[model samples]
Target chain A: MSALLLHALGIVLVTAAMTFVTRSAPFVLFGKKRGTPPIVLFLGTYLPPAILAMLVVYGLKDVRLLAYPYGLPELIGVATVVGLHVWKRNYLLSIFVGTAAYMVAVQWVFQGTL
Target chain B: MMKTVRAAFLTTLPVMTGYLAVGVAFGLLLQKSGYGVAWAALSSVLVYAGSMQFVLVGLLADGSGFVAVAMVTLFVNLRHFFYGLSFIDTFRAMGRRRPYMIFALTDETYSILCTAKPPEDVDGKAYFFWIALLDQSYWVAGSIAGSLAGSLIPFDMTGLGFAMTALFLVLLVEQWEAFRTHEPVFVGLASALGAVLVFGRGNLLLPALVTIVVVLLLMKKRLTREAYAPPTPPAPADGPEAGGAP
Candidate 1:
């Protein structure tokens, strides 16, 4: 779609043109609407979270649990994420801890050297 | 204006890992598919989709016809139509930058705009415009890197695609905490599940979005007038770029 339509030069120019037309110009179509469309407002709020959950599930799709020597890395990471999210209610902390656990698992647990 | 930029930065910072993972994946995939830096920059600049761009690479590989390509691209990117619809009030007043703002509509940019609250001294229009700019900068940078480095980087980079999902996870948790309403969450889940069941995994987002719209319409009576819309004001900031000489 966009890839084929835009080459290096074509991409830059078309993109810039679209932006120029959409944002740089004055109020046009969606602007000054009598009211926010009912459906738009509803979708705006919930779409981020639902799509996000789907993404999480998608990432974990086909992940092999028992194939790992101890299943320690993923187990620790997911548990830590759920735990930290529930415990501290901090998004950043959950990601950090889970990611760190995965790193450690790959580096040490898999090797059984650390 | 500065406050808006600062806020956008703060908000976008939380999603960097997601952006980094997805951006890098797009770049790698683009380069691998014979797209150059120009292509990367162009789409990142124009299309401005976080994950949809990645999917576009496959479409390009298939050699779909121009009309098909455009139609499919538009359909796939139709979620963006909602993005524009929601922010109409804010971007409508951008004066000069309004057009670019509309064109540069990315999910990250929209998220920034959706959550943004103009500070006392800042102009909402300018703030809205700048948020879109900063978000585009990140995408453009990723595109440039992907296209430029396409020739150099080797080995499979498929793992980077996980970034899209990772980011969605981060946002999910963030919004869950910020808002009081939960109906939207239920609707989205039900829709996504419906999409997965109906379209299978290959084309889930569209069905999911459709499901969302249908449910909201069906539940319109119960769900109306509950969500918070940001305040709107019409005035240029007290001269652009505060804190300069008289």
Candidate 2:
């Protein structure tokens, strides 16, 4: 329709195309062949945990440790999650409580200071 | 089909909560940036990557060039390359659905699929598809709601984004419990932390991933022995190892 809409569409298409490339790289590379290498299989087995751990870090990458709050909200939130998960072993409860705790910490406990 | 959908829904309940919050946030931001409901829906349906969608709002608002948009998307989503490696065989077995499965492999979907097992009666492929489909639906629905109600909803959502971090932490704990040896988990944490320190948070992921792959390769002999070792016995038929093995 309009120039802005067209431009936005272009941005969306480009972003989607690049994203698909990354997501499908492994499938395209290893999918055509019948048998995959043992090393690739090994990496597949072990890489999930590593990647999950990295994702956790990536999620918190924006936390400014040297600032006023000094990453306290995230630290407490993580502690809450780990403690609740280890103790109760409930997935939904751990995430809900941990996230709520982090919210309260950020929204009120550390409010203006951060 | 209904049974599989029901099971998938139950399994994705946690993600339902997480995605709706973040998706709505994305929608509100996009709406605030002058895009409307149609744009929000389009982005969620086409792009589907949560973090990247959030970044896209800023890029769209500033009218960034397509080259800039592509570069930013690649850098933001490069981590996804490793995600499909774990699922290559699993998705390959899904027949024609293989392409969509790969396309929908967001962080949340990838994590849940890694651990969540279908019920005894439901088909595994159907279960996987429903999970992916339902997760995306929640996102799309939330985006539309936020775009429409952007002006009406005035509540502060400052900390709601923490749900993602919480979800990841919970999954990490599950992964830690599932695997007998914790070396991979430790390797991930140490590598990421090292990369953060050395490369800073903004540019750490690529280096972190590289270190992790190299380190894992070096320890393959020992790690593989322990992973497939008969001493600890295998983790149940539906365990993480099941997907990796041919």
Candidate 3:
């Protein structure tokens, strides 16, 4: 309707299209083959853990190590997560507690200090 | 089908919590940025990538050029290319659901799909599809709710987004336990940390992923051997038969 909405729609479309391209490129490249290569299979099996590890890092990439709070909240939060997960081995419990710890650390414990 | 959906729902519960928190945050931000429920819903349903949607709100607010938007989107989402590598054959087997399976492969969905195997009696394809669908539905529902509640809500949700980080960490630990060796995990952590140190946070993902692939390629022989190696026999006296058993 309006120019702004039109522009926003264009941005959304482009963003969606580019995102889809990235997600589907691997399939499109390897899909037509009769059998998957051993290398691809190797990557499929092993790459996930590495990717998950990378994602953990990616998630914490924004934490500032040099600043006042100095990434303490994230450290404590992650420690809680790892500790709870290791000790209890409960998925939901670990995530909920870890997240709550993080929220408290940022919201109250380190509030206005960042 | 109902069984598949129920199982998928249970499997995606963690994702549900994380997505709703982050999705509501996204919706709130978009609404605060002058776009309302309709825009929030559209983007959540169409784009569906969590972090990218958050970034999109800023781009929309600034009225950034399509070229710039596209470039930013590509850079932010390049890691997704590798995600599909893990699912190519599995998704191919899904037949008619293959395209949606690919399209809905968000980080959370990908992570859950990587580990959440269906029960023996349940249909694996249906399970996977429901997980993907249910995850997206949570995201969409959260977006709409946030947009609707943004104006009325006057509360602080500063770090609820950490649920996502916690989700990843939990999954990482699970993956660590599932694998026989932790080489891939270490490789990932080292490569990503190296990239962060060298490239800085915003630019680390591509380099980190590239380094990971290269390093894993080099370590292929050892890693594959470890991954596929049969369990060792307790006693050496039975070693010959053990070695030839498979």
Best by TM-score: 2
Could you give candidate 2's per-residue lDDT for residues B66-123 as a string of tens digits?
9999999999899889888777767777888878989999999988887776888888
Candidate 2 chain B lDDT trough over 10 residues, lowest sum:
B230-239
Model 2, DockQ value? 0.65
Ranking by TM-score: 2, 3, 1
Q: Residue by residue across B1-246, what tens digits does model 1's lDDT show? A: 567677556556545655655666688788888766666776776677665677667666665445555555556666666556454554544667866777776665655454455566766676666666776786777667766664466653333343343344555565565556566666766676667667877677666766666676676566444353221212234323211111
Number of the top candidate by DockQ?
Answer: 2
Residue B42 in model 3: lDDT: 92
Candidate 1: C-alpha lDDT: 0.57
- State each model's CA lDDT, in order: 0.57, 0.85, 0.84
Please identify model 2 stretches exceeding 4 Å from their true place.
Answer: B226-246
TM-score of each: 0.70, 0.90, 0.89
Q: Candidate 1: where is the Cα deviation over 4 Å?
A: A1-32, A37-114, B1-4, B59-63, B116-127, B150-166, B225-246
Evaluated at residue B198, the lDDT of candidate 1 is 77
Docking class of 3: medium
Q: Over 4 Å off in model 3, which ranges? A: B226-246
lDDT score for residue A111 of model 2:
80
DockQ of predicted candidate 3: 0.59
